[model samples]
Target chain A: MKKKLVLYLLFPISFVACDNPAPEKKTEKIHLEKVNSNTDILAENPEIKLVGSRGFSYDFNDERFMQFYDLPVKNLHISIVDDQQHIQRLAMDLPKDKEAVNTLKTQLNKAYGQPGEDAGNDFSAFEEGDVLVWKGKDRLIAMITSKDFATAAKIEKAPKIDILFVKPEETNN
Target chain B: MNKLYTGALLGLAIAASSCGSKKIKIESINNRQQLDSVIALLPKTQVKVDSIPVRVLYMHLKGDFTFYGQPVKEFSIQTKDEQLQACTFDIEKGASDVLQQLENENGTGFKEYSNPILSWSTLPKKIQFSVQDFDGDLLTLSNKEKAAISLYFNNPVNNRITNIYKEIPPVTTTNDYQLEVDNSECGYRLYVNDFLVIDHAGARTLGVTADINPYLVKGKQQKVTVELLPGNDYDGNPRNRLHLESVVHVALKKSSKRSMFSSVVFDFRTPNADSMVREDAHSSRYIRASKFYGQLSAKVDHPFETDAVPYELPCYAAAVTDIRTIPDAKEKILAHYRKLQQAYLEKDSLQLEKLLYPLEKNLQTAWYWSKPIDGQTRWTNIMDKAREARDVKLEENVVLYTTPDGHFAKLLPAVYNKNPAFYLSKEDGFYPLDYYVNIDKNGDVQFAID
Candidate 1:
């Protein structure tokens, strides 16, 4: 049990560290308040509460990757412009349980609103790796993911919400 | 991860690089124990240095040696530039102060080692050698790559904290701007394309230089991107290995101050910050594993049944002539590949003897130095411990992808398992044979890995 736990916990940290790009600045830390959902934590804490090391993007190696699930579920990742720390893209992964997912959907809908026309009815969420996607004035969001069997096999249980935020230029708009 | 899987993964990197070797010579040392201690400790590249091959540059002993390998009473190393430096392991974690006391004695000019983890004097000669080599082809390099390589060589101070590297865009001159680069640490970098641009250790921290002025994009006053790195006493800080104290971006400024991409400064770190004492800079892990684990694993691997593997030989193949295209190109090429495989399976000395490429011959001489695999029977032994390959098992399904000229054919390996005989790890241990079989229309095995 102990070994398994160690492997499970350390695997993500080590595996991610092997490839993950360390943030450029001294990673400022804030203690995680005893909160239930990540939405509550985001609402309560004004500063960014980073849990573990950041993973870089394998696609367009810009490190446009931000991983949130550090120790376990209820995680978020955000890529920012290196100098300004401006949000280039943001993603979050939550619990996949129906109730937990519903709570997340409610929080997300209230916070960032619905998908625009370009996204059409499908939102591209969980279809080709991303579950639900949304567009904001200045950011792009990706939530939940279930791509091909080869890629999806890596994740045990798909998260409730996985979101990404990118600049308007990266979007169809 | 299973040990087999891990070993297979490390095998790919290890096997491919198993060809290069270095020699170490120690001069007369009075202290036997000191010599032993230095031999045991120094020059061995540690796992944390990303497990890359490290050659011993120099180890000069000045009579005084280790006090029984127990945190030397006094240890000092001087660089070629005549900068004297004294180092000790971290002092906070119950580390003995014997060295500290010894440092103060006789104005030994020793002080508490800065950067508790890694402390060294002057610039790294290894980095210096690489920089020297880069200077050879300065003119040939594209302007962008040339600038990045130049910046890396110029910024000697960055080596003290983090290695400076060029962020190569796939296609250069994409736009007339300096490309971004990741400042975070990663495993063994023979080249810099492995990292990303703009991804430094963290946000708001990076320095960039460009050959072209940025004002060309937007005239006069453009707020040139100046990143400011973090400042902290990173003593005992695990992440300090990743970030440079600061990296400067010396840009190509226009004659008068009116040019865009103007110079800017963000002093988040102290200038001339002392070099680090990398705990992983040595190669001990490589020594033990390469010498022991690699051989043992290879010897213990199950003998693969390569004999029964079904394959086809095309009759239409031959060697690639400078001008005339051959008649039976595919058949001739396939026959050559089949012959190579048959040579390996049947242990045929004659055919195998004729199949070595000039590069493969050089590889044999370089890799297997003491008793190079030049003999007929030695070919099997060579294949058994293939440095660039593990146990290559072929499946029945063979596809002969022909060349456009119909003079050559590529025999793609249907399936193969990378059972590395002498590698460290194998997470993704599947290489469908990296052999490039190129035969001419007349059926000559001309050139390639085959």
Candidate 2:
């Protein structure tokens, strides 16, 4: 009788084990907030925030292109003018942190692809201020400004940037 | 009696095992069918975001479908809070009917539905349905309903970014331009038309003057075509290697009333061959002594007059009928000349080869040798010997002139000579007097005689 009972118990146990399998492990979920208030987002991620209030405006005669990201704020300003007489003005808000600067550089590299490949790193982050100036074709001028106000104030402004034609071999196009 | 008891026991055991196994099998099948129905309704569907029709379906059903080598018909799930959020599903015939039945059960909250029958003819063989929420209701359907039903799902609402350009009326200003390019393996042929013209290749950039100039007639809406051929193996992939930075084509309504003289000024400098020779031979003692003596005598006499005169007679234009080197001689001296000719024809030289080659060769040879007694210096003597051997050939009366009206003109002898200078005038019948008069009187002239 004990043997029969043991056999019956074994069979039922095996059936139950096979019937109920372990449940799947779940993933942690994150709730995303809207990016409507730039200031609010900037406050939360201050490391990636733009340091200054003044940002450059770009107007391309060919409106087909809407916005370009990560372009050296300087190069994007001069590519538009057709005449030597017109003047161009540009400004940029630099990132405060090293990570942000690196990300910005990467983004600009991707955006400019060939044209920006040979462009030297003209940007610098110092204790006081940061500013860049350059002359482009046809009297077009480019300027870059960053807040980290103290850093900007401390920086020694570079001489006016002259438009240099990159040799054919050096150009990415 | 023992046999009968054993048989009875065996029969009972077999019946029990059979009953247990059948029940488990049925339960497992039922569980699977339920899961499949849930999967069929998992895809998110709302509004189409793109003009192009795109749909994605996920599901888990019993069959031969596998992804990334896993036995899954569909398995996509994400949870928020403690709620069991199931946003993915698997759909087969039976499972789809069950889902529809659930939709009907919760008519108020769960209003979404999908086609019960899967149409394999569509590009993607599945349709997806999604409900805002599920309220712990077990979906069920009859065997017959399951047999006729198939699961379908719809894709989630897509939110891909697209570029949109604001409409701007085409400007008709004379400043607008277009560049028509014939890009070939060897180089590019650029045609500039419209407002602004820019021809940039290699390191050189050439722009057309907007103001009406003699070489370019303004207001006429002139078309300038430039052929940029690759430099001799200066780099690789000559054709695709060149880039166009920008182009402008302009049509001036009234050609700028600029005088031809003001638009084009002739700047000529008579290269002092004697000075050049002296400078090049400065390192040599023989050259220094000769140059010192020559300068002293030149100051006493009219150095310009003596230096200008040729000891040998100038090679007449009549000496050779053709001014071209023979094909055989092309390999000898014509190699460098051919390069210069090419640069002149192209009208752009970034390598400065056109300016450097002839001057460099002359300077090198002049400094390296001592003065010869027979008017045969090392470099000059080589040319003399080459001419005798017929290795260097030249043609006579070969007229050289720039066109659109001869802006410049020269005559070459058929035979090579150390001093190869010759002149012509209206009186000579063979020369065009009108063209000569058009050139500025101050234009330089140097004669080399053989």
Candidate 3:
């Protein structure tokens, strides 16, 4: 009887568990969907694909991001995530002079403060015609590519991809 | 075991959260304090930010009075912005308050109050006060009154008092030599014939003397008039502020004529001996001698024969002799011809004429050459023709005659030889001798015979 009782209890418990169907592990899929959607949005707007950070994917149509790109900036990008989040994507369109790339790096450092230990070590040279990618915030991504790097060996050899995570103003405190 | 482990993990998580929250709270308070201190240091004069008491003292004294028997009350304190802040006092509240406080502290007579004292001092981080004693009495008020007296502290901390004293200029006169009457603290207007010469403005304390040269013309007296246009009486009392004790009447005499001639003789001595010799020989001796001889001879005979007489003859005889009837007439004629030769040699007529007679034919020839040709031949034809002929000359005997020294007569050939066109007009007279003689309408000779 006890065995039957145990079996019955186990059967109902299993049935209940089966009925629930182990909440589909949608975390990775949800994050993937968010990244895909953001990528689509970014692709639609050239300015967004140019400024993506590591783990965090951003909406290309954000008004603040648009305002930032509209500013008189050269080799400019939005780094949504940094080395802290492990995913890094750099997007940039640089001017002809290597000095311009250096200047952009310096400005980024000053604006975002120094890169922390998690930020993917130091910036590396961008491959020929390859868009640079960097890590930024959680699920935030950064990408940079420069048209000027094509002909400029020095600039193309070591193009600076500034990766930064920008937190929402409300979240900064 | 799993439950216990989960519970312990949760507890640790809670403790960590609390620690983080506490640290954030403490950090926030520290930041707030630092920000407050920074705001305080900033230069903020806005009334809302800070309020400081500003005490202004005003003293109104009746008439000019003496403080401690010394002439005072004229002194005024002017703010840096030229605002009149304070003046002397009669029944001064601020002075009385300070004096009473001092007296109460130091019983009765305060030795330092002998003189009418005006002094100021600042309390450390507290207040600044100024004291003025009218009766030279310091100890008069009680301690309670002293403490209650509203002391004027340095509000702006940069307040500066510029003492302004009355500036009474001496009496002045107008350019037209008239007395200038200025009876107002404000300056006067100086005018000549009612035309404004100078607009003296904002001159206080009256009677400012000015030395001005208006360039008035001599012999004519200008009516210099001055109208006293009063300035703004800053004291609010205009009565007796500007007193014209007397209008000074001064006459400016016209500058005397300056002499052109220098009292000291200027040395014009020629540096070159050669130049000196040339001027002395050519200008002084020969020219003067030739002039003398020509005048003397012109008085006696016709132009043609006057020069035939020898230069060695007595002065009167050489001047009066008739060469037409002279003894040794042939010799004189030869001598006259030789003079022409000598003229060519010396290049001087004055010298030649003194030694020989003037050739009548030569004079006639010169006279004919002096006439102007037709229009087409005016310049080139006449002058060119005259220059080519050696003997061709002007009919002016004064020009033709030479001195015995051969110096002065040298200039004549140069004149006639230069441009015949100039002398070849009817407008030019025939006898060049007429130029030398100072003959008036009466025909009386005024030649220098000596």
Candidate 4:
């Protein structure tokens, strides 16, 4: 009779535990009061500076990459440019920290609304690979966390999160 | 009955939870919709391409080029240069350091060790050497022949690492030869006919195979040699080899053109399990070297001979004007690279293809590849990789490697010799992009295939 009681009591606890895996501990803290305008990204972040310039057309191999000033990210740069040298896209890589990525995602959701489904198998500098996408009236965003299976299978590298932003017109093609 | 029912329910619940949690991640971005409340305030602006000051250059080549491995028909962008360098380019310096260290330890300069005698063995003919018949496992060898096997190293404290060789009955073949070695425990060097074919002294590997036809002569006597060396510490002292275990097997194989398999001509392996003691495995403490000879056939007739014939590549004899003599060559090269970089950023595969065409052809020719290359598809793949590649490093100062006659020049990083000036980092690896080109009389860049 006691064994039956104990087994019955254990069932609910196990079910609850399996159903609700504990929420991840926060690795970073970010507060987003409002959505950031692409035009204001440079003005708001005074430390952000233009690294160099390329011709008007976008080229991945040119001097158009910008350096993020002391950001906690690795390999953070902006590649896209307009004729006026305004940054059209920004790319930055975060260490494979799920909590941090989730935190940022939560902040983006709170500011910009819920993220949309992934769009296509398009080539992304920081935008490529397994990603979560969010679309705006004039902008497109992606959060890449992993590469293709074939490439990832051969290498045992930590997952990287790349956040990218581009103009909606450029993405239409 | 109640407990069994509960247990079964728990199992099902756990299984369901695991499967639910293992949801497949997204593969590519394909769908998205604009949120009603989200702010998007960029003014629509038309982009004008002609207003941009980027200049495009044409690619040309004028030289008899010597390809490294094979040949190709079209232009292709490549990531590595060493693979295309000719066979004569000595890319790896293996085993030389350890041998020099041994020479230094002996307080004497390096000298060739005495070769073991190849006197007539009393063992009857047709009794071949096998793993079971060696010192650890040899079956047909008489006590006299077993005694003749020199399988031990001298004491490392007193004696330097010496070369231990065994004479295999010479065999000739009309096919390409491959040297295969499996060394799990220690560093080793394998030789064919006294020619250093493999010097594997870095990280230990289970097996490695290399083309040995370049080292072997047809219709001539061939020999296989193995030299084992102790690893060194950061301070150059011989590393402790206590409790280490090693098994080495070296073989020469003849590959056929029509078939997928190759036959082993001769092979040498370590002693059997019974003979390997804990102390015997220690190279720092062992006082004797292990030696054994294979009873391989003196001659084996290969069924196919057409594979033996070498393919001769067409070498360019005439050379064009040197790129350095061209006016503002460096500036043009830098401009050309920047334009290419922009092409990548813009995802303009057509422009990228135009710039990379000559180099792709040269690479194809150098590699002896005859398949038709799809430039659009190749560039698309490159662009996709570039999209994912992060932490890009670029430099203005580039080192130019020109042809002997200065007809063409390729660019690499000035400080780093291995890769090009621009490389994209992913994890700990890098993707280097480099180009070789010639400047025409019209002051335009001609992509070179030579």
Candidate 5:
């Protein structure tokens, strides 16, 4: 009888002792490429050179005011997700050169016909700059003239054109 | 042996079950005072704000400011024989018309002219002038045109020039000049005597207003020029076409303790697009890069002294130089910016409050002395912004700018150029939160609220 009592008591304890159950749900880690580091960005876009970097953002050297069809590229900025190693955004800063801006408009018109309905909503920084947008099946290209109005009332810096290329799904509009 | 084994197993199971069932005693307070008494025994966790000596200029700027990129070369002024002080004439020629004539039934008329040559530097402040009549009523003129009428005072004794004009108020030391600008289509820069006093650029449909006293030179002709900046449309094209909504309005008002009434000293406004322009003339004043539509210039004579307190401040350049002397100052500053970015990313209000304490305190002291404190809501909004910042990263380069008096300084992320680095992400996208930070006497980088 004592042995029978021991078996009954041990049965509940044995159920509690079975601690391991089905594993809990976990987030699946994501992996991305062409944005691992400055080296990777340089390797992917051989046309440009790296200038500086901080965290997941990288600046490209464009000292000579490199031209991509009349838009004098002053510099390039690339942002990435550090943990996932994914490219979040890429922007090319254009010089505040009006002549160049005029020329680029002509060049863009020649290359990709007249622009369609306003696609300025693709980027967050499109509030003040003159914007030209081109939409393709899988890609969206936008040219923006950005301004720095945060300074005092006296210092008016010329607005620089920024050309942004991104996947269609990445944009809000 | 079996009984002893069963007894030991039972003891182990009971011990384990008892360990899991241990209950924590939670005391419930019945009233606020009871809770307060219980909390009085705890240590204080509130951050203490360190008071630092600094001079502040209370400047308030409000306006409908926009940027429609254009240079100030579109406007000019000249005085004949150098009799009048330079920039003494205020010109209000329409963008498309340099000469607009007015005629009335009373046979009273005046030919409007721009770039007029005048010689009247020695004339008294209250010179007589005449106005043209339109339909038995006074022919209304823009403040700029009215102010420019002074240039026509060739001979003060001439009755024709003095018939219907109102006398300009004399300027005094305590007088303040309030400047207001409204531009819906583009941004602009306002220059007082070639010194840039307002740069409202790259924005649309904004009105800016501020006191022009600090920027004005007393006893000198105040030259106020607005240069139109190029703006973009909904599709990012240059906004060169005039719509019903497009308009530009600029006015300057003069007031003082000695006078109960504030008189407009300068004004300029685009004619109502709905009434003035048809399909044919739409592009006349709205033309991109057109000199006619891109520049506005005016001049007013302020013969009294202005208060210099706004211009005078402690040297901020020295503070910047001193901060640079610290070991790894650049790294430290970058770290500070990163710390802020991280704090916002994590929605850490305590850390943000600690970091922003100096700024909040200075602002309270400078701007909110008479108001009640409501920091909780402010902190909540700040934390919400932090959570909305999304995926933000600190840029490598930091740029510093200082006030001319060297009393205040602000740091900017090179990526943002003139703006600070902390951008609050929103449903529409990201916009920067204005922060002017400096290294205090204690060598800690804190917000400079000026």
Candidate 6:
């Protein structure tokens, strides 16, 4: 009789234990060019700031950022979570100089694996054309769009970094 | 057994919670005795913090007598959601007067604020208190505004004798200048035409004098009002109670042809006949006579025809003391210009540096450049500008703009010489820069620019 009582209690207890499992912590992937695993980088580094938003422009003599290269990056737009001061997106206006662009591309090639092959990858993250992209396992993608080679010193017009990155999945795990 | 112990500990931790995380703070100043007593009477606990007195003594001016209220720093509790809660004060017993927070005419906060003393004559002195923003949720009071507050007041602490002055001014004439005031333990401000002439602190109503001529224009009678500011008047106490004296006007004998004086001086003292022998050095003259307490105030009258020139420093008379007044200012300026060229041609830095001219206090000067490369905020050394000038050479056609009185001129180089055109000032002599090079009449540098 005692054995039957123990058996009945053991079956229900085992069933209840198996019914629930601990939730796994999900991680988000963010890699562009030489930059991979930006999870902690975005959390720690302060967002870059630009005074003007109407159009793209950069000045070499701007004393705002002493650490960054003074010449190439024309402008930047930082995405923050809601009204809280949490940075989500980081975009930079690439330099007009071809040499600087090539150097940046070389670094990106090492990290994102030689850019995607998709032709005119404006909206899609497919591998083609001059639009290079790297897709992640967790549905996060980093995209880069390169223009025809122009010498950094001879670039007559000031250029805008209009390329944008979007999250593939609706829920940012 | 260990598992049971862990569960028991967790249950205990869940049951035991902190009393609170928010509190109110109050700081007492000025009247510490009454403030301490009031705070002692109020309820404050572990969760409810009330008062924290920072020990800092305020500096007092020697002869000032306005009794501004003691500021009390008070803060309302802030909730978890970051909202300020309403806070009020409770006074068990003490003398008190609330200083209302200064607000603009529209009742909004004003940038320029003075700690205002308010009195409810009808209310009892002990329970006087003010509520700061009863409906608003934001508690952003400035340190000055916070400390400008007074929570309570106790009466006996501020010992004051009210209605002490009985014998006051009744009917007085212009010639009847003597005003005998009762000998009180406090001092008073004597105002004529709303201007404070006498802020006197003395024991007896004995001989004291001041010249009130500065407040009067020629031929116009001034209305006088006097206020007695006591040393210990705060918290609606009887100490600040001012028994305003009666208003009286002194008339002057009309003159058909009064001299229009440029400068006037009034001697409030009862001048002795012996001292009046030689001419009074001070051009100020007393046209009206009046006395308060032991002091007399002098009123000087100037002629209506002559315009009164305000006092200015670095003036022509005051600056040109080293030599007799220059008969021809234009000749002197031109001669100085030629000397300046000689110094520059010689590349003589020392001589160029010495191109300094004496300036009287408040000397008026200007530049000839249309978009003058200069604006002087303070006294600037002319030598510095001379040194900054890259190349100094004489230009053709020196343009001279003479002063209104022709006593001074400003010299500018030829207009086409686009170099930082040195249009130095010409006051008695050529000043290579602005005011500092100009010496006062005493041959001392006392020049300043506005």
Top-scoring candidate (DockQ): 2
After superposition, candidate 6 runs with Cα above 4 Å error: A1-173, B1-132, B135-314, B321-450
- Per-residue lDDT of candidate 4, residues A1-173 (tens digit): 66754554343333223322323332121111222323433334322222333222121111112222222343334443433334445455443445555676786676558866565543253344566666655556666655653344343333343334455575555
| lDDT (tens digit, per residue) of candidate 3 on B1-450 | 333333333433344354442111100111112222222222343112122234432322222322222222222221222222222223233445444333333222212222333232222011122333322122333222211122222211111110000111112211112222333233344544333334443434343333222212222343445444333344633322333211112122211011101111111110112211245544632211111111111111101111111112112222232332334433433333344444434445344233222222122121222221211122222223333334423323212232222111111232222232112222233212211111123322222110
- TM-score winner between 1 and 2, please give it: 1
lDDT of each: 0.30, 0.25, 0.27, 0.39, 0.41, 0.30
What ranges in model 1 sit over 4 Å off?
A1-87, A90-173, B1-391, B394-399, B412-429, B434-436, B440-444, B447-450
Off by over 4 Å in 4: A1-173, B1-319, B366-379, B389-392, B417-419, B426-428, B440-443, B447-450
Say which prediction, candidate 5 or candidate 6, comes out ahead on lDDT: 5
Stretches > 4 Å off in candidate 5: A1-173, B1-181, B184-186, B189-235, B238-333, B370-420, B426-431, B441-444
Scored by lDDT, model 6 comes in at 0.30
lDDT of 2 by residue, B1-450 (tens): 333334333433454365553222111111222222222323434111222222332323232322211223433432222222233333333443443343332221111212122121111113233322232112222322322222222211111100000111222221212222322112222322211122222322233232211112223334444333331122442333322211112222221111000111111111121222232544522211112121211111111101111111111221222223223222322333334334333433332232332232322222221112111222223222222331112233333422222222233333322222231212222211111111223321211111
Residue B300 C-alpha lDDT in model 3: 10
Report per-candidate DockQ. 0.01, 0.02, 0.00, 0.01, 0.01, 0.00
Model 4, residue B343: displacement in angstroms? 1.3
- Please give the range of 10 consecutive residues that has the lowest summed lDDT in model 5 chain B: B65-74
Query: What DockQ number belongs to candidate 5?
Result: 0.01
Distance from true location, Cα of B326 in model 2, Å: 25
lDDT for residue B232 in candidate 4, whole number 0-100:
35
Better of 2 and 4 by lDDT: 4
On a 0 to 100 scale, what is the lDDT of residue B254 in model 2? 22
User: How many Å off is the CA of A40 in candidate 3?
Assistant: 8.6
Task: Report the alpha-carbon TM-score of model 2 versus the true structure.
Answer: 0.16
How well does candidate 2 reproduce the true complex, by DockQ? 0.02
**Model 5 lDDT at residue B419:** 37
Error of 6 at A107 (Å): 85
